[model samples]
Target: MTQSASPPNRALLELPQVQRERLSHIDFKLYFLGELRRTDVADRFGTGPAAATRDIAQYKELAPENLVLDNTDKIYRPTANFVPLFDHAPQRVLTALSRGFGEGIGEELKPMVRCEFPMALSEPKMSILAPITRAIHRNKAVRVSYTSIESGRSEREIVPIALVNNGIRWHVRAYDRRRKGFRDFVFTRMENPVLLEDSPITDEEKVDQDVQWNRIIELELVPHPAHPRPEVVMMDYGMPDGVLSVKVRAANAGYMLRRSAIDCSPDHSLSGPEYALWLKDPLALYGANNAQLAPGYRNPRDDSENKPIKAL
Candidate 1:
């Protein structure tokens, strides 16, 4: 028989939620950024110097081997045997790094760093998103009223496997019961999402069964032939050999291509300043369903049939 895993530190779990959150913040910075200070904790949590000090001391007491104080810099750095107190997800960590941390604590807490980026025009409604996310977490299906431009409004059941943000918008990758296939449902278009806790999902509805999502496609991108100063393009992409190779899920290849403004025509036909990179071989995307989203791509079979007939 397989051995069961050990439980979390009982004393750590017994601390107040606020203190636990502060400890998690300390662990997050130490593990990722390699150092922490009392002021860092105070600024992030809006706590006094004494409270921050107490929290750090508390964390050290709970995990004695996790950190060591550098007397010269007065900073706490991770020790050789450092272990994280929290399970930080990669997506959450990346978002915090890009946008600044403590977003969920409250709107009053200012970002730790000065940063700016183009604002997303829209977001999914929490009312609809909450239950869908709950279903995803609990491994259950959800019934939803969804609308699509191509098919209009309809009622459907879906087993949500993952959520995807395709540069412009957020969508859920799920097994659509009505269509009997895996489909991307834009989160904003969903309404009245009700988790089907009693409805058991089958093997077919699981993420493993999604072929396009499981398959990986390699894309070889190079500077566009018509681009002025191709060397600058190469340098911008850090491609010393004049090629940037990207591996993406076949389901998301077209989105990645479109988001990067890559020219995907077989002849490098698209011309514009924005088209810095061109797909070295458009055939690499032949089997991708979303390949139509790529700029200037025409199926080879369609091109062959369009050729004008010549006299023998």
Candidate 2:
């Protein structure tokens, strides 16, 4: 759950979707990102060379123009006039690299220079998300024992709509049948989701009416004024003209702000090591557009007696 840990795109492809993800990943990193090694294929799918070889051949058979074998390197290189068969998303590529390094897929960690990354304190199990995914795809309702800072642990019936990444944590946007309102449920907080056989989506539970989830809001960020070297800070953020405009869904703005540690306080002095960036316009995050979610900025659980779902 490195914020980017999504279940592999399996269902959209043809039959034998079990291996669709492995095949797609091999081709994706090969043609779009870099060369694909059989070691990559083996490590990714936890399969031996024989199976990995078959997957590679299957991918080539489907999209023969994409990858060329480099015998000397024993790797598949992206070919000229290569076109991707499976769709690629930039975030997915970055996350795969992060997870690969974390799992030491192709490299031994001890030999590489170690760098600090914000470790995930809580990551929801894939077992929990799979049922939620099935429920959403089928537009069905589910039952789960959810532990929230607001309601604490309770059994509830929910019509799951979408699985969302609020930059740092994964959340499910669902219409609570009990509450009769939409709420964002942290994936980690859920337990034993049971997809109901007969539950159906109600008109009140439609995602289209969830304005905050759909509305996009832009926030301009600049290096904190307290930073001694603004020029260096500018280079760090790659800000052009001393400003970086970030467009994110209103519902997810709080997460980006909290993730970046951008101070939105009125007296927004840098608080700690995390607060290197500050919001240029505090109101953009706190004003009307993002009001419902952004007010509970950093410490969301503390203020959630009146809000739906705590801060990611």
Best candidate according to TM-score:
1
Worst 10 residues of 1 by lDDT: 303-312
Best by lDDT: 1
| TM-score of decoy 1 | 0.72
For 1-312, candidate 2 gives per-residue lDDT tens digits of 021222343433554767777877776676545588887788766889999898888888776777888899788888766766666677665555544433453445321123346777777798999999999898889999998786689999998888877667788988888888778888888899999988767787888877777788888878877877878878988886898888987766766676667777545654666666777666565433334444324333344433443441
Show model 2 residue runs off by greater than 4 Å: 1-90, 100-118, 287-312
Instruction: Show model 1 residue runs off by greater than 4 Å.
Output: 1-37, 42-98, 304-312
Determine the C-alpha RMSD for candidate 2 after optimal superposition of all C-alphas: 8.5
Clash pairs for candidate 2 = none
Error of 2 at 166 (Å): 3.5
Per-residue alpha-carbon lDDT of model 1 for 244-307, expressed as tens digits? 9999998888788888899998999999899999999989988887887777776776845223
